[model samples]
Target: MLIAQITDTHIKLPGKLAYKKVDTAAMLKRCVDELLTLDPQPDLILLTGDLVDLGRPAEYDHLKSILAPIRQRIIAIPGNHDDREAMRGAFHAEGYLPTEGKFLQFVVEDYPLRIVGLDTLIPGEGGGELCAERLEWLDRTLAQKPDVPTLVLMHHPPFITGIGHMDKIGLKGSDGFAAVMERHRHVELILCGHLHRTIHAQVGGRPAMTCPSPAHQVALDIDPEAPSCFTMEPPGFMLHWWNGRRLVTHTAVIGSYDGPHPFFDANGKLID
Candidate 1:
């Protein structure tokens, strides 16, 4: 099975720009174009968070329209920029989101891999947290399918990324989340977003990572006092391929570029 991960889209209402510069909707359309053209297309798509810039209903409408070309089921969690109620109403028809919960968390058992999506959104705040309630729910949920290879999807990465500015707004209860992971060894990977750039770390010895956005990326500055900023870096997404036993990941960069150059000629001789 293959899964495509796209995050931090920050789609604003039609014709609006994110941060007064990036055209998130257009970028996302390009990313969607790339996804549609992939061979053996992804069986599923996961939107990690920040699907819109202001958590507005119209933005969700625009986002849905942009994502409409995708035929695969999409499972999305809320990022700090997302409003719980708005997102719930936007995707309620899909039926994965719990109808009466304060948090938008759910587990998907339809595929070969069990997927557990966690809500880390802290409304009107840039930071996120995994409070006791959410942590307990994750623990109990994982326990139910201990033998299944699972994928935990959360909007904020659980480890402190060296990018200090981003780290300050990182997940608050990471230690607790890690403790929960210690008991669920069946989790194959922890997929997260919000960093807007690819980052990887280990939580309770399990691999966890963040995917790049389809739009602007958090500038790669390493100082604690580094001013919060974003860059027009080459945007990308992630693909996780499960071959029955192990899950491998690859980063697929977007945009047209020079490619298909071969190291060998038609006769199989090295090109020199």
Candidate 2:
């Protein structure tokens, strides 16, 4: 099974560039185009949040239109910048959401893998939290299907990435979340977004990954004493492929850029 992950599109209304710079819409289109060209296309597209820059109806409309050409099953959740109600109104028509609740939480069970969407959005805050109710729901859901290979998807990562400023806004209830995952041995991977960069780590013995934003990426400076900011790095996404026993992840960078090509000689000597 193959899964495509896209995050942090941050679509702005009136189709304007974000942060007075990045042309997010164009970047997203490039990413989508790249995804469509892959052979053995992804079985499912897991969109891990900040789908819109401001969670406006128009922005969602634009997003829907941009995603229309994708033939794969697409699942999405909200992020700190999204308005839950607005997102529901826009996507509910597509029947992608299971409940009319504030959060988008559901399960996909038709494939060789069991996929679960968890809502970690916290209103008016950059940080994320899985409240008591959501925690209880997840705990019960995992217990109900103990034998299936499961992948949990959410907006915020539960592990720290040492990106100092971003880490400050990571999942707040990580301890409780870890406790729940510890009981579910069938969960093979935890997928997430919000960092705007591809990150991989292990949480409670299970592989956890964060997809890169299809738009702008957070600067890669690991400065522990500076303020949060973004960078001009080329946008990208992640593809997760599972073949029975192990899950493999690949990062695909999108958009036009220069440099990084190295020259070499037949004798393994640098010829640049």
Query: What lDDT does model 2 reach?
Result: 0.86
Clashing residue pairs in candidate 2 (N, C-alpha, C atoms within 3 angstroms): none
| Candidate 1 colliding pairs | none
Question: How well does candidate 1 score on lDDT at residue 253?
Answer: 95
Query: How many residue pairs in model 2 have overlapping backbones?
Result: 0
Q: Which sections of candidate 1 miss by over 4 Å?
A: none
Worst 10 residues of 1 by lDDT: 220-229
Native-to-model Cα distance after best TM-score fit, residue 123 in candidate 1, in Å: 0.9
lDDT for each residue of candidate 1 in 1-272, tens digit (9 for 90 to 100): 99999999999999999878999999999999999999999999999999999999999999999999999999999999999999999999998999997899999999999999999988888999999999999999999989999999999999988888888999989999999999999999999998999988899989999999989999998788878899999999999999999999999999999977999999999999
lDDT of 2 by residue, 164-272 (tens): 8888888987888888988998999998999999888888777888888988788787767657889878779998899999788899888566877768778889996
lDDT of 1 at 178: 98
